[model samples]
Target: MSDQSSDASSRPGASLESGEAAGAASGTVPEPVSEGPGRAKAAEEKPARASTRPVPAQNAGPEVPKVPAYLQAQPRPDVWLRGGHQPPPGVLTRLRPPSPPVIGPGTLWSVLATALLSALLLGDGLGANLLIVAVPAALGAFFAARSAARRLRPWTAVWAVGGLALLAIPALREAGWPVFLAVVSALALGSLALHGSRSWPGVLLGSLGLFPSVAAGARWGWRGVRVRADDSRGRVRTAVRTTAVAVVLLIVFGALFASADAAFADLLGDLTPDVSIGDSPWRAFLFAVGLVGALAAAYSAAAPVRWDGITVRPGKARNRAEWALPLIVLNLLFAAFITLQLVVLLGGYDKVLEETGLPLAEYARQGFWQLLWATVLTLLVIALALRWAPRGGPGDRTLVRSVLGALCVLTLVVVASALRRMDLYVDAFGLTRLRISVAAVELWLGVVLVLILAAGVFGARLLPRAIAVSAAAGVLAFGLVSPDGLIAEQNVQRYDADKTIDIDYLKGLSADAVPALNTLPEPLRSCALENFERDLARQEAPWYSSSWGEVRARDILEKHPAQNHGTECYSLGQESDERDGYEEDSYDPY
Candidate 1:
């Protein structure tokens, strides 16, 4: 039995052999099996375990406390789970979307139309000019606002329109204060109503509507309150301070200048007109009130509107055509009205001449009818050219064709008029004035030809180009043949006759004479010099007036100059002709 036990213990797998071997190796029973077979195996197989006994728990001072569950594990971050992975540093995270592109023929056409309207309106009176600026600005604001909030577009439009209406008050000044006030009130109320909803747009509209009135009131009167407070001391103080400063400045300046030069005193005295301010304070106050009210109304109308998140894409081609047709029609209507007025003026000339019974020579000399007709004809031709010109084509061929046609028409008319004039003169007056008559006809014809050439060169598809060409032609022709081509004749006559002062001959002088006449004294240099010369000629005694004996004496008197005349008379008599040299050759004595 002993031998069997010994053999079993000595086997490698026997627990007794391991225990004895570990005890003999200076170790107590091998450390109790760890939590698993692998741990137990490791403990049994380790050389260090064979050399050491297990230290009892009591011997180790207070076995190291197991880590609390919360602290036992290392921290796992929340961001890592939530954010997936960190992006690279310095990379842009948010980018704006690309803007929609402007496309198609309508976009280009709209821009052109707006530009034309802007130019035309700008050329109109001050009121129209203001509208030109305001309307576009308002539209721009509306679009901007609509982009922000689509719902705000209507409100923005209302505000802009209101502002424009208020501004229009200054334009129609003939309308009394009541009308102005009513217009302003209606605009303000309408703007408010349009933006009644409680939104950002509404708030903006309300503020804008009130701001102008408030500002204007403050500007014109001290009635505006700067702050909401019970005490009035601040307001009173401000008023007093302002008044004191103004009075002090006025008094100081008045005293200082009182002792200065007479001119300074005169200027100071004239600073206030003789008109009395007394008993009219109410009128002045009313004017001030009206001004403030108008300004306020303007402000209320000009609020910025925002239409958020509204995108506007171009309409279809058919829609564009629809819009374009109306615009074209309107332009044509305007042109027609202008033409009608011109035609009326042209047809009225014969009646005017007949009523006046002016001789053809006198009529030709005056050139009032000729110039009036030319202007009317030029305008009519230009209108027709523009009307016929094609607007939406690829090239300016249509405009070119129209210009050429109009020019041809104008030239024909001028030729026909010249021929008619020649026939009338030869048949009616029997006057041989071909040189002057032909010169005038040639001058106008040359002008028309040059204009046609210019219009052809520029290829006048555009209205401005057409207008410029017509204006240039008109100005040149008027300069050349205006008043019977007197400008050219005046220089020629002056060269030949040493100072030809024919009052009747020089009646058609241009506004260009204003600057030249400025160098001379007022009354002496007046344009009335012509009338004075005419009166002098009429006063001269007719040849038929003399009796038989007086006729011979009168002829002798007409042949020689009067004695004791000044240097001016001597010079004039020397320059005069045999017909009336002996007459008072001096300046008018009356």
Candidate 2:
């Protein structure tokens, strides 16, 4: 803690710098050796300045200057640099002191409570369940960082909450499972990485590899609990163990006796239970383990250990021939493909389909995914090329730039093709949530490609920042559009054009679709309403699982009395109000 300058001599085993320094330390004038035959031979090598030159230090090691901790040796280059020999060194690696234990009693108790809450709230409708989960999850990060003496990046928390909102949003839940997963995963990465690792990409990679930490944290928690519970007297531990053994024996004998006697079985009834583990525990044991994992995941998220994230490969300069040949060839092929696409576009869809002798639906389904994959792979190729492209020579740079520009331009055509495919498919077969999402993704990809091209050509280099923003924007747009409602609207539009409305399918959509279905025309609306009412009736939301979606669904169904004509579950004039007087009493809010 004291401020004192550190120097080389203080460090044991450090090499001595000069004879003068050693002489100074000893305060002695050393006597010179006699000029023997060896001295004569050495003198002959430096005859011009033999006497003037300082004699080599006798038995002295080479001098090494002291360096402060903050002033370290030069970090190793990234792997991509110099075209690979060995893997890049861990640039951020440091032998840091072990972090002090976080002593936040509030944090510890809150995380434990969160684990219990998560366990209690499982199997509820996703909206409510996710809402409940996010609170503790976010708090977990805050607490963990606090414990580790790290600061939480505000934007990371913002993104995490935004993602959780997407999950909780009623209508948007049907935006496609994969889309939701991506948003949630991004949220997790942003939150964990905000304080977990040193670099953005590193945080991302490490966040995915956090299972080990989670397991360790859980084990740590359990160890902590055990350490506290084992009193020095040993009596408390002994009594607990004895009681546990007795309980197991009693349960085993009781079950056997009940099985032997039918009368006793009837008396025991539900108490005998259907599920038991090792004749000792109830099914609650499974629930307990789940709580443990949840606690572990939360603990690791909030207070992660030190992680050295992935070191990106260094960029290496390449020969002009290496950079030019592949890019030029690829660009030419892309140019040709794009030219053909443009020609076909001018000729119209019907004419092209006629030439190919294919049905509209089949043709429409063909190109969307392929074009998407090609565009994604194209970006990958551009990235790898950029990493290895030559940095020296104007001719090589110009060639790279020209080819890159052409490839980006051609890639736009491919993105457009993908969009067109989705459009054609939707036009022919009507829209679903997945189709709408695909179209949106395609549009976003187009915008991103435009950004990429602009950055590449103008030297703006906005790809990294642009990519994250554009992707998040695409997902947030889904929230704006309202997936369940959009699906209903598009399907209804399709029905209007060509009498093909599927009421059952519409009813089958999430609760978010309910309000939209209510807007449908006449008798059809009534049938859809009946289907939804019956379905919702069967999916009774337990009190703990109450969500905005469920609550609203309940209120809406109450307002729209099923006409009872379409549903087999209800007869004419049936009340159908079994849950009318139910209380939300299971949970204690305080």
Query: Which candidate achieves the best lDDT against the true structure?
Result: 2
Regions of model 1 farther than 4 Å from truth: 1-240, 256-264, 270-275, 278-375, 385-590
Q: How do the predictions measure up, each by TM-score?
A: 0.27, 0.62
Q: Candidate 1, after superposition: displacement of residue 334 in Å?
A: 27
In TM-score terms, which candidate is top?
Answer: 2
Q: Cα deviation in Å at residue 183, candidate 2?
A: 7.2
Question: What are the per-residue Cα lDDT tens digits for candidate 2 across 505-589?
Answer: 6766766677777776666667767766877788765544554555666678898765644454233212232111212242211
RMSD of each: 26.7, 19.1
lDDT of each: 0.40, 0.60
* TM-score of candidate 1 on Cα atoms, chains taken together: 0.27
